[model samples]
Target: MKEHLKHDLEQINHLLDIIKKQGVEYLKLIGARPTSVNHIPLWETQNLPESGYGTEETLKIFNQRFEPIMVGSSGPRYLGFVTGGTTPASVAGDWLTSIYDQNTQSTIGQGDISANIELETIHLILELLGLPDSFLGGFVTGATMSNFTCLGVARQWVGKEQGKDIAKEGISGLIKILTATPHSSSIKSLSLLGLGSNNIVKVKTAEGEREAICIRDLEDQMIKLNGEPFILISSGGTVNTVDFDDFMEIKKLKEQYNFWWHIDAAFGGFAACSETHSHLVKGWEYADSITVDCHKWLNVPYESAVFLIKEQYKILQVETFQNSNAPYLGDPLENFGYLNFLPENSRRLKALPAWFSLMAYGREGYKNIINQNISLANQFGQLLERSNDFKLLAPVRLNTVCFTLKDSEKQDEVGRFLETLNDTGKVFMTPTFYNGHSGIRAAFVNWMTGENDIQLIFETMNEVITQLK
Candidate 1:
């Protein structure tokens, strides 16, 4: 076993050397391939001949089978779902985390390594988002779990005032959630929490507007409610174009209606770092709870997300998973339970990479990187406007640009052209639907992306459009 472990370590070290040498070039080569084909079977079986294979042979088979399934998120042009490429520091830290393989359920179990890293990461992330440090923060799996944790606490807070203990006795009465333009993930969270997504009352907004959820319509919805405690879910950034719902107006409605206000800032929360774009998410500080995914805009590796709440004790109220009579598990002074506030008991040490990234690049460094992405997005938007064949589909609010082809029949044609460009390994862009129309979408969330990358994307787009014409 020891000899096998040593060989595996050597292989990993060799792969790291190859990664450093090839850098972005190798990533571009891999990213230019089709991720999935329609005819490809979703499932395949590998038969074993009654005996287990040796370590090296097993490892080779594992890489051959699973490596192609991985997406090229590290590539500069991967703009599929507002996902960001991981930073160098964060990726290295992720390697270290895998090597250590420490479970971070309790402080005592891991000698406070997990707890201290989480705490430090929370402070750094809060500072980056311009949020108050007094709030309680916990590292969750991703934005979905973060939203679940925040909304769960919100449910508990409002449910307690109505003579019910939701944490112990689950939500019994009809709990209605209200949202102004709900992301699919938010709706999924609501459904998972037993608060049906269909039970949510939608607020109407203006025409040709990316920002849905009118404050007046929301107020009207609240007034009609029959004194049942309601939760108002506001959006910091819309999934379509990074459009921010008027949070200031939403906060006012929260005060008037007395509903728990929760902000879903999964993709755009990091925009708080930039002076120019921070106002887009104004009034975020007034939220009862906020969800941020460090893996998204912060450019950290996947599985690094956080949920922050204004009232620290509210988390403890909803998530104190402790029992008194455990023989070996209960230490009064140092005993920490895993399933406290988060839903999961045995949680991974996902915050290590985030903590390492923050330490390597301080607050100023983070702010600069975020601002650079915003600038790149603006440049891309300008280039789109300059093209006669392309039309801006939405306002480039932060780091996302949505544009469509001028010739309606050539919409899908343009998409195919973009795909061809990707196949040629020049740059990467994706397709998204805006206002019921197909268009190209580009999200600039990679730190390695710059003016040259933006120019390459636009050049490729121009070439593709011309060829289609």
Candidate 2:
């Protein structure tokens, strides 16, 4: 045995205690940590030693090399890119996930029940979102992968409509996809699936400063398809202003059309927890597939999201992702393994963090998180509204505020303003372009964010603008 390995095993408890203490200190000081930092020079890579260093020494080296530049992307004032902070319960589950290191590939006859736990966690998520049992869901790394999985199945279903198996035989001819203001991740998914992103028929958004789909334009595009089967990718909440497509109208169209409907709910799906905002997603339950991100509004750790597809399309999903040649893995239909349902052959117990979070904070608890974040967002938006130096690009639709310089002629200054604001290390926001004008977007998804944080951000923004002037 390696000397370092033996030493690590013997002192595992002490090693873990050190890690626990480090984690506690980081979490305790997260709010005060810098949200952005200037680039630090990388540590020179070293050749492998003849004998490995002991675990404690190795950790010390890592801390010295990398810990200083670790930014506070998960902290309260990180209002950038719809980032969410980890909950205490989620951190607990994440730690256990690494310790156990279980491969969550099957629910039965696999000598592990972690997959069963994942299935139950999916059920709990559906219940929380007020979705019907008709939908079956599985966890993936993030919204991008979730979108890929759903659209992969959609591609197969489109092929099936023409009596072809695209998964086995490869993409055949043009597969039409229609969307208005789809996220970049969805376009990336199309490219990954061999469905050309340029092939998407860009539907028109609603009039004025809206990002929502224009129902009339969508209907016109459907007519142009001339009865050919297609896929419609809709947004539950857009990233910048959190604009939601009219799901009720889309549901009506689904009854008359033969196209598959998919919704990229991502962070916005949490609106179901708000009685005041729940109406925004009234008919999303009817979607053929839905993507939701646990790392965003759910306040779980990074790389956690779920893709929910209708139970009726289980066979299609299997066709899209089944490991057909592996006889030892058993029949996908009869035995029922998640390995045959989604992407990736080997997966961690990715559902654990989400399960712990949902269990620790029930429906009411999530409701509070969602509502509180929304309130904070509106509070920030109100500040932007009253500020003489800034102007809102759109109303606070959900949990994001899109604003820009009060003078449209100073549009070129948006990036500079954002850079200065982010450099403050007091708050972080991302630059955006909206309605032909450059803008800055502050998304409120972190659970620790409150009125105090908003006020701090507001004051900081004013100070930065004054400096810029």
lDDT of 1 by residue, 1-469 (tens): 5665667677876756655555555455644644332233355788873555545567567657765565566667676677787877887788788877766666555453566677677888888788887667788888898888887777787677688867677878777888877778778888888878878887786456657577677778888985667888887877778878788888776676777888899978888888888887888888888889888877888887898887554433334333322323333224543445467766677888888888898888888989998999898898878888888888888888888887777766766766666664565567778876788788888777778777767777778767767
TM-score list, all predictions:
0.86, 0.97
The residue pairs that clash in candidate 1, if any, are: 319-340
The C-alpha lDDT values of all candidates are 0.74, 0.91
lDDT of 2 at 447: 86
Which candidate comes out best when scored by lDDT? Answer: 2
How would you encode candidate 2's per-residue C-alpha lDDT over 194-220 as one tens digit per residue?
999988999999998799999999999
Residue runs of model 2 more than 4 Å from their true location after superposition: 326-334
Residue 86, candidate 1: Cα error in Å is 1.3
Weakest 10 consecutive residues, lDDT, candidate 1?
324-333
In angstroms, the error of model 2 at 47 is 2.8
